[model samples]
Target: MVSIRSVHGSAQLLLDVTGGVTDIVEKMHRTIAREVNPLNRLRDMTGETPVAKQGHTYRIIQSTTSLLKQGLHRSLDGLSAQEEWELSPQSLKITAALNGVCGDHLEASGNPLAISMHLRNSRGEKLQPGSTSLSTMIPDASPRIAVLVHGLCLSHEYWKGHNEGNLGTELQSAHGFTPLYLNYNTGRHISRNGRELSQQLQRLIETWPVEVEELTLIGHSMGGLVIRSACWYAGELDLPWTSRLKNAVYLGSPHHGAALAKAGHLLTSVMRQFRYASPFALVRHTSAGIKDLRHGNLLDDDWAGVDQDDFHPDYRKPVPLHEGTRHYFIAAAIGKQVWDLPSTMLGDLLVRLDSARGQHSDDLKKLSICAEDCRVFEKLNHLDLLDNKVVHEQILGWLA
Candidate 1:
């Protein structure tokens, strides 16, 4: 069931998006036209002057633009009187996908999916730390707190709806730990998100009704990098929350680098090698968050003064696990064991085993987790690391 408001908002977004995309295509078309020289090649045969041909092309472009605008306007005018119905889950999924890809853009443009920290209750109502709101949100705030941070393109609701036993519920039932969720725009740089998270965590702690005892952080994918960034920022700023950190857990975190991002970088490099493909290379001009994953950047200085499109060798400053907090890591493989070649190569279909394990040739860049502290769950992909039974058991054992 789609609401009129959602439909109208999406229509507006589509119109703006179409304009942006067309601008790029128009530029590319001009470049192609110049290279092809189709008009010049056929000028004599067509018996047309260069000026006339140019006028014709301009008219065609204008007509197409007008038609597109008219079509969008007509669609907007065609909405039915019935405003509510049972909406398909697919529509929400599509909206979430759009947000994940260009959430930073949406936020910049003040669009519908601009994300924020929404500490939502079981009924999907937002919670606040004010006295009245706190009582309603958390009837019994526990001393121990486990904050679950979702990965790229995900909302905090992901943890709640995952097929496995809800992580927050499990921790609460087994260890008397209260759970907090963080929802954020993943399209921003990890360092940027990290700085904000550091401040937010401090506020959350300061506002807690009970005396904060122990704090544990759990992050997945890009969320892991964000946690690491937050820890570094907190330490640099001398924030009090870092002092209470008891443990940090990373699930399928690409501590070194993600191969997919590297591959995308390589593709962009190759595309830009040709003059014709140069403009189209803008296709790879993704958000800062995706770019930071190239070398697992965790500090503000890591990307200072570097042009977003320029490719540089990975020489990022090393950011280790928080010294005072015990760190645990869970890596996943799609095979029976770690030695399986395909599993090692694919590494749960996103992060490689070595990268997830924070194993690097340079000891300076390597994360210092003992072999016994790391576990590899088999027959699971990256997303499965979120809800798999074996992975959940490992998390339980580590927390215990």
Candidate 2:
């Protein structure tokens, strides 16, 4: 049976999309008619085109909007929150994808699907991890916490693959470390999410049923940047949780910056140079979180007042790893041979080898991971890091 909640949610999304499209079209039409269309401008100057006709177009748009609201409201009139069904994996995936693309906007606009930072159980239910709620949530939770942060456009559920096992589960069975999955909005600025994560970790550790002896963070891609950002904030605030942090592992993380986002920004810039293509360039108006990844931004000041569509030189401050924490990095490449430049350049498809390894031309921006602590795997893409057997073994070895 189709869910009323889904129906209502779909209708609301449709209305929002329609409204945005309508506004864009109206603006484009006005611009083209006034400036691009010489014939219309000539007609206006010659008094051949009636101003009233243009006014009619706006009136029709207003009337259509009113009708759309009425129809959507009527369709959702009998729907109640109780009628909502549990979110399927597919539905959750779609929601996560949307959040990754426009999460900052959705959050600013107060969209219902905008995900908040939460610790989730294996079944994907949120756990408070507070003293009062920890027992009811996870009765046998271990004091050694291993937190897993997923990449952009993904949810905690993504950690559980189809056939191959994820690192978190494997580590749980091999070692007695308890795994906590984080579900958060990936569209917000990395620093914003980082600060929130820092605070949340403090709360989580302090409220643990037992003393947190060790806290290890395993982050993939952008999740690594968030972890790093959180670490900086944790130091600034002098949180007690910082003392408990033991190991920090980054898998396929673009510690320097991803080339793909830079290339996309170039394309958007080219499109914005012309009048007609300018509106199309709006397609690149992704969330601030994604834009930050372009230069591996780990601080709020990195993006202060920067235009979303324009390319800016790297303005990030150097964020080194915590001195007390052990850092491990793993990068993947699709090339069969490790020496292949093509595959090496396309590190894990989304990150570059040098970037993932935290190499930088700017001396200040270079990270402190030792050469021995880093590993690179050939014949693997970015997502493969989650389930690859060899990668799993390497992680187990590192944790051990």
Candidate 3:
């Protein structure tokens, strides 16, 4: 057996194997190398791009700035203020004006980018930051469930209940799709999260006394990436649920890669020039995914520098999507005001038309409805789409 010394998530791994210790060390070193380098060439856009890499970067930055304002919202939590929610018409409009200014960054200067998600985590709770494995409450009879894996900094709680009904609960009750929320640390490599999601899903499938026949998934923002992580994990596990997966819906999911992630990647390098940040920043720049420009949960996920897997375009490039049983892409587009109306798509004010649309997704048949006939609730923001009355209905309708 070979012993390879590694430091990932505070675990000192002495992996016992058939090979001798020297061989293990060499393999481990190679893994580290792959883990460290993703884009040999930075700004490596596809052969067919609507604009230049720098142009994409500029657009992405503008879109990112728009979303950043929402992140910066004086969040009592990721919801409108309680008192504000109860305001009279006049006060409501006033508060809206105030929030509008604060929220304007996402709308005006473009969107700010992040790579992580924020959900309230309690001590000792299984749903830790970057957590991949969770055991659901084993109801007497197996219940159909859909697992929601968020993209970047957002966590399970990202799907909040609006008007006594949240996205998860709504999916289960309205459509018999039980909701299993997964929260993983976004700072880790995509492949690490992918593997972890596989393990966790495997555990979920094996534990179910009765088979869960139909399964669906919805991912928002980077959470879309997390869903892919889980699905890729499913492929690795060869679990029944992987194929049992009936449909997948992505709202503002960046199937390829987000220019903002690249932007944040660059910003981290700049931040480093001055001083340290959030302790986690020191190790962030080691890899492109690790740098986590948007909504980062640096404290969670054990899969950072330690995991030795290459980053795939399914991890980076948005379009030319990988095939799936029933892969559905629902982009939240934020367009500029035209002659008489606002942009038909209003993504959470974070992700924009191009990024969310996965313009470059792999060679899957790009549907015209891909952008036009989508279930559009034009006034709603990105996150709002998950719980927005019409949006949830739209998700349910899509499954139908």
Candidate 4:
């Protein structure tokens, strides 16, 4: 067993390693594309160069950068069990920088990033209140509908994977459940939002002015945890709506928590000084995201509550443990086959098979997966759980 301190240390190492190789990864973006105006701009600012002449310099910079990034990602990807998930602030900064650079260049070239961010957040998007639609709020009967919650760092659009997209839309269309896309800043405190979500679910159940038949939930990654937290609160409330939990499925939930998240907290604590220099300090620490991430894992101070004007309703304390045995049904996906473990765990890139499962207690009463048996998706990764067709088809078929 690794100590939390060691977990932090491993994450710090991961960050340091990733940070050192960031420029290279960014270079990969510059390369493989025909554009080279940035190189001309850099040269003209410092010296003088024709736009045509800038291609060579751009290629050189991009070449060197790509090699470094490829090497780095491979190394990070190759980390062993004890260190696989660790991330440092340095790594995150590198990742953030990579994200910014990629997003900026892509936009300049008239291409937006993938994943359409249609929904606002857990708070819901702006809609005129008076007029109602079927998707907005079901009418005339019990509003007991299907609500869809997305995973961490993702949007409600995650569920609408049609043609290699998420299945949010399909759930509404095919499953006959009112799909409510739950989106939030996953970097925030899990339990706090859990309560807020619980309140939201309670309101969702009560407000529709109709009888809710079954409140089915499907969560991926951190979304799974949030759903569980909400359900735990609802069950405790003993409300009829709470009893409507008919089917719940988790794609790749880390029921025992991810080693990587905890490791990331450690990385920031170590490099907070050197990296947090100057005005980058505020944006780096707060707007950039470490503040909330650290707080979520109970590592850094609570930034959302203290700094970001966080708001969450209070409820009974969560079990803080996965005890899905009480649910009407539960299902989870495991991508890796036993023969491929250590080298490849058929996980959704981020979540592991063991952690995605329930406690090893030899009792079905304590089963983490609510299913009498689970469907193991042999070759899917974490992202594939949402994007892959086979996985979605299996889910739809099973539910049907």
How many backbone overlaps does candidate 4 show?
Answer: 26
- Residue 273, model 1: lDDT of 86
Alpha-carbon lDDT, every model:
0.77, 0.82, 0.46, 0.48
lDDT of 1 by residue, 228-302 (tens): 999999988889899899999999998988888777877888888886787778636577778878888888788
Candidate 3 CA-lDDT value: 0.46
- Comparing candidate 1 with candidate 4, which one achieves the higher TM-score? 1
lDDT of 3 by residue, 1-400 (tens): 1111101100211111112233334434433433466442232344232223344554465455445434444332233222222223343233223222222222232222111122221221233322333333333323566777665544454466445357776666677765666655554555555566666666666555567787676777666666665665565466556766777777876544454554555555564453223222323324323333232211123234432222212222222233545666665444433111334333435655544554433444232234433443455556666666766777777776
Worst 10 residues of 3 by lDDT: 1-10
* TM-score for each predicted model, relative to the true structure: 0.85, 0.90, 0.52, 0.52
Better of 2 and 4 by TM-score: 2
Scored against the true structure, residue 381 in model 2 reaches a CA lDDT of 90
Where model 4 places Cα greater than 4 Å from the true spot, the runs are: 1-144, 235-240, 266-336, 342-346, 360-367
Q: Write the per-residue lDDT of candidate 4 for residues 186-242, one digit (tens) a residue.
A: 544555556667776665565554567777777777667677776665655554456
- Against the hidden true structure, what lDDT does model 4 obtain? 0.48
C-alpha positional error of residue 358 in candidate 3 after TM-score superposition, expressed in Å? 2.0
Q: Pick the candidate with the highest TM-score.
A: 2
Consecutive 10-residue window with the lowest summed lDDT within model 1 = 80-89
Candidate 2: which pairs clash?
A: none
